[model samples]
Target: MGVHYVEGDLTPEAAAKVERLGYTAVWIAGTREPRLTIVERVLAATGALAVATGIVNIWYAEAQAVADTYHRLEAAYPGRFLLGIGAGHRELGTDFRSPYQALVDYLDVLDESGVPKQRRVLAALGPRVLKLAAERSAGAHPFLVTPEYTRRARELVGPDALLAVRLEVVHCGVEAASPNRAPARRH
Candidate 1:
């Protein structure tokens, strides 16, 4: 299983701890620009643990730069790094016009730059984008979604593409109050 941890200034020591804890992968969420150096350090610290960008903002990170970093990391680590790229939200001051087109163009650039479809994922939520992700990249990384939404997404993406959903766990003190509470109580 992969741990979706926002590695904001995460130390190499902590990354090693994650590996020791038996998590197969670590998903690091970035805002504008992804910390490629940090990712490299984390890979260096751990053995056999995959490190993925929960998402690298397409609006801020240059496609060529991202592609170069991907190639370097792949050479250094080999099948240990996954690049998740996304067009950030409009509320975050990013231009939302033609976002789909922008993402397609970005993916095209990555393709030309030698970052293959299997090495990357798209942060997609809507139907159109999800379709694009399935067609162009390895899979879809949908954050803050319900199980029902996931079921539908799976149907849309078909059986071949990977569906990496980010589930949020809210602590409500009482298990009865939480929607996703387990049937069997833990001691």
Candidate 2:
């Protein structure tokens, strides 16, 4: 797994390097829309590296648009694309009522539009959403989680579902100072 910022340009050259380095996938974070063009560019540049949205916000993107993009990308790239979607945080000023139902509705549209179960993942944190992901989509993508959380998530999703977790690592040597002063790292 690798992290790419939505604001950053994941150039074809950079994507090629990621593939050459033996990384299986490139994950983009805070994706509010279905950035199919970016996914296509990465897939075109690399032979096997899968480009996944760390999360496309369910509230912001239209389900039909996402399904259309998924179909197009699937046709062009085959099994090299994974759509990771999420219900964004309520703190972000979104109308966060009944997120579970909203996600269910979104997945329903995708299903209707031909985005298969194995081609998608859900950004699931709680038990409800994690169960939904396991039942409805491919698996669960949980961010900034601990080993215990991962273990619990795996149990919740069951053995068949994919469980991808985002872990953060911090290197602090003798020279390292405060949190802000030290250069933090993530993986």
Candidate 3:
């Protein structure tokens, strides 16, 4: 399991605490990381725990720069970092006219910059991107997903793909795991 934190909320103590809690990985969710300092800090703060960006928005960050940081971090921390890239919500910018295409081009740049396919992941909120994530990268990372949605994602990605889901715990009169809980839809 992994713990998701906002980039700014991260501190060395918080990171160590997560590792102490037995979470194998940490994620900086919804942050536009044109640089990788946060990933490095998380790595520096923990032992035997992986760090991932979930994800760095393709609209704001340059792929080549992202790859450069990825290479540098890997050189220092090795396999403990996973670069999760995605085209964030189209409503965030006018440049997102073709999000899927933009993501493809960004991946091409990362490929040229030597960020290996296995070291990266993609945010998948829908089927097209989910399939692409499974085909071109290591796997799909979908947030706020239900079991039914995850099962369907598995079917779409096939057997050998990674499906790293981001979820939340509610403390109310919880019905989150109800069989009738509606499948979430995010695109």
Q: What would you estimate as the lDDT of candidate 1?
A: 0.86
So what's the TM-score on candidate 1? Answer: 0.86
Instruction: Evaluate all candidate structures by whole-model CA lDDT and list the values in order.
Output: 0.86, 0.84, 0.86
- Please tell me which model should have the higher lDDT, number 2 or number 3: 3
lDDT of 2 by residue, 68-164 (tens): 8888888888998899998876565556569899899999999999899999999999999999999999999998889999999998999999987
Candidate number that wins on TM-score, 1 or 2:
1
> How would you encode candidate 3's per-residue C-alpha lDDT over 1-187 as one tens digit per residue?
8889888888878999999999999988867767777788889988889998999988888888898899999999989999999988655666835788998998899889989999999999889999999988999999888888999999998899888988655443567575433432222
Off by over 4 Å in 2: 1-9, 90-96, 170-187
TM-score of each: 0.86, 0.85, 0.87
Query: How many steric clashes does model 2 contain?
Result: 0
lDDT of 3 at 17: 96
Between prediction 1 and prediction 2, the one with superior lDDT is 1
TM-score, ranked from best to worst: 3, 1, 2
What is every candidate's alpha-carbon RMSD to the true fold? 4.5, 3.3, 4.4
Residues 42-111 of candidate 1: C-alpha lDDT, one tens digit per residue = 9999999999887888888888889999999999999999999998765555566688998999999999
TM-score-wise, the better of 2 and 3 is: 3
